[model samples]
Target: MEDAKPMLLVLSLLVVAILPTLRANIADFDEVWKKRAEDAKKASLEAYDPHPERVTQNVNEEVHEALEGDDGKRRNLKKYNGPCTATNPIDRCWRCDQDWASNRKKLADCALGFGRKATGGKDGEIYVVTDPSDDSLLDPKPGTLRYAVLQPQPLWIIFAHNMMIKLSQELMVTSNKTIDGRGANVHIANGGQITLQFVRNVIIHGLHVHDNKAGNGGMIRDSFDHFGLRTRSDGDGISLFGATDVWIDHISMWNCQDGLIDAIMASTAITISNCHFTHHNEVLLFGGSDTYSDDKVMQVTLAFNHFGKGLVQRMPRIRWGFVHVVNNDYTHWLMYAIGGSQQPTVISQGNRFVAPPSLFAKEVTKRGYTPESVWKSWNWRSEGDLLLNGAFFVESGSPITNLDTKDMIPAKPGSFVARLTRFAGALACVKGKPC
Candidate 1:
């Protein structure tokens, strides 16, 4: 028994001595594993192609021509140049121009006094459209006398669902026009059937635009057609296009099929601050279709916004512009925080992102798809992929540079309360006022 015990001890020592060598071998194998992972990551990034065709081409050119006129030259007219009237310093001239183009036609009609006045007064006098008879707001009968009195105050179009006033086509607004809804409850239900076309210098604020879905289903037409294509019964609560120096503040957007807010074409110098955005496809998007290339699309700022739950799609999808996204809270996004075309430089700084593993799980389950499948479909990488591959994976093909995540407020997964605090803090700073 004693001899057998000595033999057993010797065997144990031998195994221990060999163990280090075995570990060394394993370490060598680990290097190979790391190399393979890195190679795979490189391949994945290379393979990722957004199928640029899916993006409408030459959209910028068409939109520019439509808005700026055919010579591709901007008018230096003094009427077009001025600081915005909004109290926020971030609001600027370009937004005013964009607003003008969006609703010019509508304001022209109002200025000409073509519609029946719910309140009888001289033509061109400011009136309110509170009922279904406001079709006069869109197309007034010919020879409708131009209103003799120009109301110094902006016109207000208040639409209740029962009003049945279909104000769908894009309204071209005149300069110094403002359209205010009394409150967020003022609903425009499913008026998406109309196409709102070219106009300028208008403001549509403090209204809930839901189920105003209009647009051909993802078809490529003229740049205007792109508007119709992206249009959904689920259109944004408020949308600004081809205009500049505009302001959208203190609004809430939820459950919209598209972005909560979007700006396209040569739109520039816009500011979206102090807004609560959630439950939508995207919070914001900048730049226009791929076909256009102009430097003016740059210089937009999205700051001090609160983003949280019910958002089931991308965050800010941007392209061909310099977008400053700062000091916001983004929680529970189904996909990337900021993404879009390979062009345009996006600066995302001082924003907090609070996502839990469970949020990812829930998002995956809601889509009835696995995380791997989603990654494959979008050609995206997961955070864990960094463990296998190197951190270099983040830099590959990333259009956004100067991204700052440090000092971001952290929150647990699915903790809406924590998200709100983070968002509130950021919003406070951005608005330069109380949250």
Candidate 2:
């Protein structure tokens, strides 16, 4: 019995000594299994890789090819050569002081001819003051001219004051005239209640409409008084109130009370492109009144534009419409990209969203905000929303089957440059200039 006891003790001691070594081996085996699992996951992802650069190139090529005809030609030419500069001959002479430099006899004859032309002959041609300066030809009283020329018709109406001379509540633009700003500054100051009501096929291009202290008491009031002054407009920058086929391009608006641009009441086929809209409450608004369900589909396209900063909630509060918001850079702001009610079909694609921290990080600690809060505020559901390198947010249950990060084109630091490069050739062709 004594001999058996010593043998048992020695065996127990050996087992105890080896138990630690066995545990170490098991741990080692577990670590190897974990590494294999991770490696398999990585390999699986790599198998379905979508090359980003290749996709970007494909998109760029397709855009360029599509814009190669019609508008593309004008765009290319304008890029290489600036806009054409042409004006009336009399205006050019007056500008050069060539008319003033001539001798007294020629000047007198010129002045007489000008007067005779201003006053109609005995044939009852009915002389009307077409030019603002031609008010001298009248009896020199307010509202005394036989006929006041509307806008953009008289070649002498180059500046804003000239256009404002006949700007009235009852003033109706009955003629087809092109009011070219000539890339110059046209200011409307204290012009009382100007409205572009019942005008068609009007193109107000390359003009800066600002600081018109026009009291909102006449026939037309500022759009801001009716609608809140969140956007950069005293009234609205350009109100297409019951107008159609209006094209507003290449204009910059800031520091006004209402929306930068407002299209209301059955305005159809409105195209707002290549314009910078900032420092406002709402950049672009559609469907002020819901009268006709058929016209609700006004078909507004907001493309190749920059919308951000100096304002909170800068999205188009669209109701009842098909709005295609594509290729825009939306960064540095608050609230929804688009928020409104009704059966509005919003096609929001190809946009870069740089959230607070990142989509992947567990927590985002910046400006005392969190990932959860940011996601909620932006109406982003993380579970459904896909994250590409910690950016971009699509709606939950979206029809987007796949958002392969590998297929995403890498952008530069700022969203503006990224968007430009993404849709560079198309924008260049559309704007008639290099992007």
Candidate 3:
């Protein structure tokens, strides 16, 4: 342990004294927090109010128009202009495809961060998961989801029909694979888990994954070439281990045995977008722990998601990584929304957080058992975010001065969060319906 007395003094002077004023610039904290609560209520109403324009134009044109203006706060959007116009930058990359199934590879091109180029079977053949049974954990048949993911080659896996698949054990996913459940209703529920280990270039999209349980590990086939034994799984909906270039999008997850999504062992370049999470304790965990300091390479983008109902903490709890949490709706949480340790850099923008009724849990963050002094030095920042319902973000670390952070489009505002995260969950896209 360090000599923390001096650090404690700084924490008291900066965080305890000056921090409150910097957060809201008000003398009475309750008054300002009350005002924020009212504002959040108003914003929530406006968010849920029916917007006719949504039916007319699929995307929010005002947001796009705002970015187009020469007000000089447009960020770097001009680089992907013309055809690539969306309210959310990540959506602009892939959602334009009405023919998304035919051009499924386009999703890989739309990713940002360390996982930008995760093609996941973009160059391979289509494999349909006609069977939902995981009866044969080893040497699964071609029609099952397990078998489709195990093939070593790049493959696009799609469900043949609406089905809820229960796995006897965790499904070990191989590299260069895309499991796309867009056109059909698919659920990986009833004690099923998916693991990505020592692989690259994978994409998982538009699936409801929940009700997972700990796996009593046995013979599991990881790839077409090899079969291996494993330890017990923690029942994470998706676990990334020593993997890179992974993109998971448009997922709905809840009530997992562990973190809904856990990325450990130096997984980098990943994006988790347009997802919904609920009824979980620990939601997302990035990096392994404090001892795994080499996880400094982790760069992740969490965008356009909805954290709704019955959540506790770790909307992502991070350690030794740079996490970008942008343009999402956080409707409720029992404990805290975001937390971390090991001096991670967290950038939160263009989001809305409506706190739960508990007074003690009003704050939106938690420092993982570190003394105030050490945690205060971490670069945790909030810009253009809407903190409502008396929800306040306790920020520390250095002010954002760089151009990349300076020119942020400020989409994380509370008003914009509703529209930005309007489409958070699995879609019931019929053949010709807008997804």
For this target, which candidate reaches the highest lDDT against the unseen true structure? 3
Candidate with best TM-score: 3
Query: How would you order the candidates by TM-score, starting with the best?
Result: 3, 2, 1
lDDT (Cα, tens digit) per residue for candidate 1, span 1-435: 987998999999887555432221122334533443354334323322232211111211222232232231222313322333221212221123334423322322221000101111212234444443313332332221111112233444432232322334322232234443432144444543221122223444444445445432232121211111222222544554444434444455566445666665444445455456666666676654554564234445555466767665445666565554544555556554566553554434334555434433222111112234332333222221111111112222232211232222221112122221222211111112221
Model 1: CA > 4 A from native = 1-129, 132-175, 182-184, 193-200, 215-236, 356-435
Per-residue CA lDDT of model 2 for 166-234, tens digit only, reads 222212221122233332344332322123333334444334443333222222111212111111123
Q: Which lDDT tens digits does candidate 3 get at residues 286-349? A: 9866787757767777877899988999999999887877777899899899999999888787
Where's the lowest-lDDT run of ten residues in candidate 1?
Answer: 111-120
The lDDT of each candidate is: 0.37, 0.36, 0.74
Q: What is the lDDT of candidate 3?
A: 0.74
User: Model 2, residue 312: displacement in angstroms?
Assistant: 2.2
RMSD in angstroms, candidate 3?
15.7
Model 1 accuracy (lDDT, Cα): 0.37
lDDT of 2: 0.36
Spell out the clash pairs found in candidate 3.
Answer: 114-269, 115-269, 349-412, 350-411, 350-412, 350-413, 351-412
